[model samples]
Target: MPIYVQMARCCWIICFLVFSSLFRAYEASPGDSDQLYRACLSQCQKTSCVGARCFSCCNSASDGSPLDASWYNIKHLYFWWNHWDCQSNCRYHCMLYRENERAELGLEPVKYHGKWLSRRQYGFQEPISVAISALNLVMHFHGWRSFSNLIYYSLPLKPDKTPFYDYAGLFNIYGLLAMNAWFWSAAFHFREMDLTEKLEFSSFVALLGYSIILAIIRSFSLRTDAARVMVAAPIVAFATTHILFLCNYKMDYEWNTKVCIGMGIAQVASWSIWCGATEHPCRWKLRMVVVGGIFGVVVKMLDFPPYQGLVNSEVVLNASNIPLTYMWWNFIKDDAEFRTVNLLKKVR
Candidate 1:
């Protein structure tokens, strides 16, 4: 490899580490950490208002019966989608009240509990991300379908009536897992909570680890079953153990960040080196994916604030991956096409 390629690879790895830091450890945000905000929250929880802008849910009973005797309040759409109970309602409205006061003094909106203040952010928080996640899921499905059709339909099959691609089933599983991860991601963005958070993390981690394994298997040409298993067993084991550590032991964001960064860098390095060395027709396509991933990370690192109070850093990040998804599936189709033809030539 050229010196420049080596340097670029190193820098890419560093950027990936920074990417993991986007999942920062939970901390109080500027608005939430303010003295006045806390005071307002306390008062609101007690009295259910800061002047006239009151939320009836704030004074609801412990069992969720409305204290204000407003029948429609409990049936409100925000409560249905956001699951905002009395206390959370109090915290949210108080934050908004404080932000309004600050805005009156010509101050900009600040984050409360690690989120930018927005009226639409209440129900189905991170709506843009949720939509993008769903789109990613759809793209994954489409990619998987295209790849499968290219192999099983577009190309000739072996005597047993299967695709000539050695890892056809493996890539199939990869596609399914990719779709599953995005499904959970959409769910998590739609309604974030402990359960959804775990589902999202576990699904994503599993896909990440599986992707690394696929990279290893493909890069090293582990064609035989034993050879592939020899390379994949340890990685699968480690990924499973890490998931257990998070789900059963502790959901430590910092530790998870380290694990993800390490695995992500490994995955990126594997693909980068292979793409550099391979004479394969689709090599440049894979390179584009890697470079595009780096560019996406750069965009994410430029996090200023949500654009027009709608799109956030994460929204852009997910959107960037959408094109890459199409590219990847396209690459997979081309790979299948080339592999079946090339290998058949060797046999002849």
Candidate 2:
């Protein structure tokens, strides 16, 4: 085989491996599974043959667990007729015995789920985060409406020969990506399934990286299609590689966080510098967007959280998008009016 063909085959195999990793589900730790509990219950039952609490005999007075016989009894009584397996009943009784001993020693009982106060206060799902993500989706809709008007009504007003006017389709795609990112964010907060979480993170990274591409193109006045494509291609490639690495390689939270923060800083800096240097009437609106974005970034930085109510970093970022979207609408409308006026002048 030709060397190039051999390389292509290697590439295909690597791609297959990367994609295969995405389908692999995250497995919980052994303790969270029922197998160990069942095995322990079996041994306990075979030895003692208790009525409903097989592990009841496993407790010792020296361990201070004997004082919690009533606690174990409560669990045994609860699971007596529930069709629970021997292991499950034994596990429940053991849990009560442990908690009772912890109470005696004045130590907090170990949490089986996690230390997240959000789960304790609001159950599994963070409703506030979901609501904020929904609001962000609505904001994206408003942005899309403005962008649609800009494309359908305003874009056509430009001289058909202009290369810049041809970017309406690309702009529409970028807008759709933004909206879809928000949609996934909402879905993740609503259910927090593994797939949804991955989608949400991947979508957000795509949007953030693409926004940097847009900023560079728009700021440098890259009008020609080729120029825009050339400017965007590398960033898009980087974004794609980042996503593949996350799915296939180690999903290191610190590494992902640093990359995201760097991209965000670049995006904000590009827009801020452009707005500051330009003399457009909409500069103040862009400044407002910068302010809102910075506030969102600050919220993200202070993300050590109980994750309850509206205190979630994702929720605040989603809410911040509202003002930024409205400001973008006003700025785009201003630009559209400028384009319409210029077109009419040429016609006359």
Candidate 3:
């Protein structure tokens, strides 16, 4: 891993948490506060119409919420199941109408509530990001599947039937954590709700913190369980404390950024060093990943608005990860085989 992995993960978490913590959340475009947009919203709430387009949810409430609506109306609104209600429908329609007018007037598109305007597909609020996150999840599943097959099905097992590779279990857990993190990431991008946001933030931080501990274990070759636990205890403590603070107490964006930056830099540096020292066949892939990760970090730092009001910087960041992820998993597979073969030869 290089800077991009940590930077991408942290930036995604920080961008949302920071913006939400710092300002009033407007679910629509930055023009949400504009007099015209406000007036349009008010009219939509009262009349259930945005221009000639009318929404049934709006008819259920003056404020465009179904909180006071009858059961049938509530059921009707939730039937779509994409989490769309009167307020969101009104905001989406109004924002598009406003942006279309702005385009005609030659005005640039602006962010809404700290979010760049994004095109939604199949009810995904950020379709590109959601899709890419899902792809990343698939990559993990692929890697985990292949690795497990190689260990359990292809290779000879020990007396107790455990895989020959010493680190097999560790990497298996790693793959699971990676998959879990990506799943939450896709969900968060689909809709930035309180629960999804917390899970997305917590899952990645946990994964990263665990990765750092794993890096220490693998790089140092801490084979003994006690040695590994000694290396992990502090990291686990910090991660648990931070997650609790973020979820239970308050989300301290600045503090979290500092912690992630420090830990991420160390993790990348250690892996780069180990990759260089290791004579494994897949070391080349690890080296390539290191270089690419650094370049990606640089890429993520350059901030630009969504391209064509659809693909944003975050989506691009997620896309950049797909290849890195593939190569990294490939390296893990090779490493596992290499280690297993070495163990068998020792027995011989």
Predicted model with the maximum TM-score: 1
Clash pairs, candidate 3, are: 29-112, 30-112
Error of 2 at 219 (Å): 1.0
RMSD of 3: 7.1
For model 2, give the RMSD to the true fold: 12.8
lDDT (Cα atoms) of all candidates against the true structure: 0.77, 0.61, 0.75
Candidate 1, pairs of clashing residues: none
Q: Sum up the clashes in candidate 3.
A: 2
Candidate 1 runs further than 4 Å off: 1-44, 48-52, 58-83, 94-122, 225-234, 245-262, 301-303
Lowest lDDT sum, 10 consecutive residues, model 2, at 112-121
TM-scores for the candidates: 0.78, 0.63, 0.73
lDDT over C-alpha atoms for residue 144 of model 1:
97
Angstrom error of the Cα, residue 228, model 1: value is 3.7
Clashing pairs in 2: none
TM-score of candidate 1 versus the correct structure, residues matched by position: 0.78
By lDDT, the better pick of 1 and 2 is: 1
Better candidate number, 2 or 3, judged by TM-score = 3
